[model samples]
Target: MTTESIAGATVSTQANVYFDGKCVSHSLTLADGTKKSVGVVLPSTLTFNTGAAEVMECVAGGCEYKLAGSDAWQTSGPGDKFSIPANSSFDIRVDQAYHYICHFA
Candidate 1:
């Protein structure tokens, strides 16, 4: 399989694209075999549900997010990160393309 590097980690290129191309991501396995994804989100407002806890690190650009059970929205930009609990959902709004690394655990 083809490999690519992100956040200093080398990972495979195979991945699943979603939301009618609004989002594209590559699946990766860490040295410890932990699964994660690195992706780009085009300008849009999207809601997502998580089955596992996720740490989303903004690689480029920025977005605003409203976490589950919270009405306040927070903004995150390049070099910033946010966390989502398992079995939760969040709303994200982007005015420009946003790049991020999502670590699942």
Candidate 2:
């Protein structure tokens, strides 16, 4: 797949703070002005709430996740992507470093 660059976008390095430092994301706006975050999660299990719909692509390592309302835990690896609904939450378990790009919709 081809990747498009987000031209003239600003990068924010601040942690979301909700994860209590377990996750840190760098935010950038795409050429079309869509905001996205690329982040790495240290080896830890954490829960996160989302304000918008998200498509999370595993860029390097991977993690297992249990989406809200679901009891099944799914595994995603490099190039794998998962969708989370808006105003929802999910649980993620990382045994090793997990890198991902989160596209907000």
Candidate 3:
């Protein structure tokens, strides 16, 4: 199931914009100190490096991703998720706005 809402989270008002506004997100900290980010990627292709393991949970729309050192491209849609290892990277292509939650592990 997809996560619809988060309660008792400390949200940073400022948005983290990347790729010249192709992607934007707001940082969030749960009561237990779990880190997360709610974001949307506009129609574009982008590469992202991970500092920690991440679970990309799709909340709306979709995106196709190719992990570093892999030739296969995978699709992720609403309610779907994909994992990226720490210190890894992934390339994402979006034809439409892709909404997601980045869950740090």
Highest TM-score among the candidates is held by which one? 3
lDDT leader: 3
Query: Model 2, residue 61: displacement in angstroms?
Result: 0.6
Q: Write the per-residue lDDT of candidate 3 for residues 1-94, one digit (tens) a residue.
A: 7788889999999999999999999999999999999999999999999999999999999999999999999999999999999999999999
Worst 10 residues of 1 by lDDT: 1-10
Clashes by residue pair, model 2? none
Q: Predictions ranked by lDDT, top down? A: 3, 1, 2
TM-score of each: 0.87, 0.86, 0.97
Q: What is the lDDT, from 0 to 100, of the residue 1 in candidate 2?
A: 35
Relative to the unseen true structure, what is the Cα RMSD of model 3?
A: 0.7
Q: Which stretch of 10 consecutive residues in model 2 shows the poorest summed lDDT?
A: 1-10
lDDT of 2: 0.84
Mind giving the per-residue lDDT tens digits that candidate 1 earns over 23-95?
A: 8898877677788898988989999899999999888888999999999999998888899999999999989
List candidate 3 segments past 4 Å from native.
none
Q: What's model 2's lDDT at 50?
A: 87
